[model samples]
Target: MTEALYLDNPYLELVEATVTAVGTDGGLYVDRSIFYPQGGGQPGDCGSIEWGTGLRTNIKNTVYSPDRSSIILIPRGDQDLPQLGQTIIQHIDWARRHALMRMHTAMHLLSVVLPYPVTGGQVGIEEGRLDFDLPEGETVERVSANDAINALIRADHAVTTEWISDDELVANPTLVKTMKVKPPTGAGRVRLVRIGADIDLQPCGGTHVKSTGEIGEVHIAKIENKGRINRRVRLRFGPSAESA
Candidate 1:
């Protein structure tokens, strides 16, 4: 299995890894990876991998191998592939990843501001959105929700992560926020992301900033009606759409 360095240190921009194998279509499998594979509502990381002989491949995306053991780096069609067993230096597009982290953290704050069951969500580099299973006839005030989200960001709440056993998570089902996506449990442990002392706590395996303040200014771009009881709230970075 590949060591997922991103989970432990989301701030890491570069890493050294060994090319363990080459997959079909020029995918490079690495023994250790800082690139986050697409999962948990967050997209895969894209960057570059430099190998021996000074050759480098522009990684288009990152993903898990079949059976989900090692990480495979998908290079752009025009990039050259490194030979297996070669040591490679991996670099993350830190600016892009940081934006994703900030946006992801903002989504958590969105969940807190809305305080409703999350039906679905997605984290993006510049924008994020969460679909809430809100009751019919209830309305989310756009301006107020935007202000609330900004308040949390200015508060600079610390974001931390911890692990709990599957049994513990089962005992405290409230820690989960998503209705359709169950936390991966076969490993006997699940990762939890907590903001502030009690701002929000939920099972998440995506990358995040160290503090809410790093997210800077954010606001609700729009609230769309997806269903009779579903509200899709889109969050965007920088000032609120009205204020911007």
Candidate 2:
């Protein structure tokens, strides 16, 4: 099993790891990883791996093994695979990963501002979005929601995580906000992300900033109607063009 270093420290950008196995499709498996594999609406990480003899390989993406037991680092192309048991330094694209972290945390705040059941979502380096289940006759005012989100961002709520047993989560169903995506279970536990003291708490396995202040100036760029009751809110870094 690969030790997921990001779950403990999203700010970690580099670490020394040992190559344990090579996948059938040329993916490299490491004993431990700083890379965040693609899942839970967050994109996989991309970076480079440096080995002995000044050798390096560019990682295009990170993913999970078919059984979800191990993390796989996919090379950018047909790069040479590192030998098994080779010691290497894993380096994640810090700038890109940090941006995604900021956006991800901001999305959490967005859920608070809207306070609706989330139907879907996506986290990106420059922007992030959440689809809410808004009933007919209800609406989300862009200006108000935008101001509310920025207020929380300025308040600088501390972001933290904790583990709960699968049974505990099963009892407290209200802790879940997303109507479509459920937290992974069957491992006997689930990871919950909490913002501030009581601002928001939910099951999430994605990377996030340590504080909301890092999210900076974000605005609701657009709100689209996906269905009769689904409103997709798009969030972008910096102030909205109209406000700027």
Candidate 3:
């Protein structure tokens, strides 16, 4: 089993790890990893690993092994695979991941700004979007949503994480906000992201900024009607198109 170091500290950029196994498809499985796998609407981390003889492998992407037991780091193109038990230092692209972290945390605030059931979402470094199920006759203006999220950002709400057993989560069903993407259960426990003392709380495995302040300036770029009750809100870093 690979120890996912990112879960403990998403800010960690590098760590020494031992290559535990190599797949036939040329993917490297390390004993530990800071690389986030592609899932939960977040793309996998991309970086490089260095080992003996000044050799390095550029990781093109990361994904879970079938059955989701281990994270396999796929090399860029046909790069040589690390030997089993080889010691190497894993490095994540901090610039890209930091943006992702900021965007992801901001999305949580977006859900709060709208306060609707999340139908779908995507987290990106440049932008993020959340599809919400709005109440009848309800509507969200881009400027209003942007202001609400920016208020939270300036408030600098503390972001924290904790774990609860599956049984505990069962007793509190409302803790879940996303309707389509269910939190991975049956692992005995679920990871929950809590913002501020009361701003938000929900089951999420995605990495996030340590505080809302780190998210910086963000704005609702657009709000599209996906259906009678579904509205897709897109968010971008920095000022919005209208403001720019």
List the candidates' TM-scores in order. Answer: 0.97, 0.98, 0.98
Rank by TM-score, descending? Answer: 2, 3, 1
lDDT of each: 0.90, 0.93, 0.93
In the range 1-244, model 2's lDDT, one tens digit per residue, is: 8999999899888999998998788899989999999999999999999988888899999999888879999998767768899999999999999999999999999999999999999999998999999978899999988899999999999999999999999999999999988999988999999999999999999999999998899999999999999999999999987789
Ten contiguous residues minimizing lDDT sum, candidate 2? 74-83
RMSD of each: 1.0, 0.8, 1.0
Q: Which residue pairs clash within candidate 1?
A: none
Q: Whose lDDT is greatest here?
A: 2
lDDT of 1 by residue, 1-244 (tens): 8999988899998999998999878999999999999887899999998887888789989998877888899999977788889899999999999999999999999999999999988899888999999887899999888888899899999999999999999999999989988887878889999999999999998899999989999878888999899999998877864686
For model 1, the superposed segments whose C-alpha errors exceed 4 Å read none
The prediction achieving the highest TM-score against the true structure is: 2
Which scores greater on TM-score, model 2 or model 3?
Answer: 2
- Which residue runs does candidate 3 get wrong by more than 4 Å? none
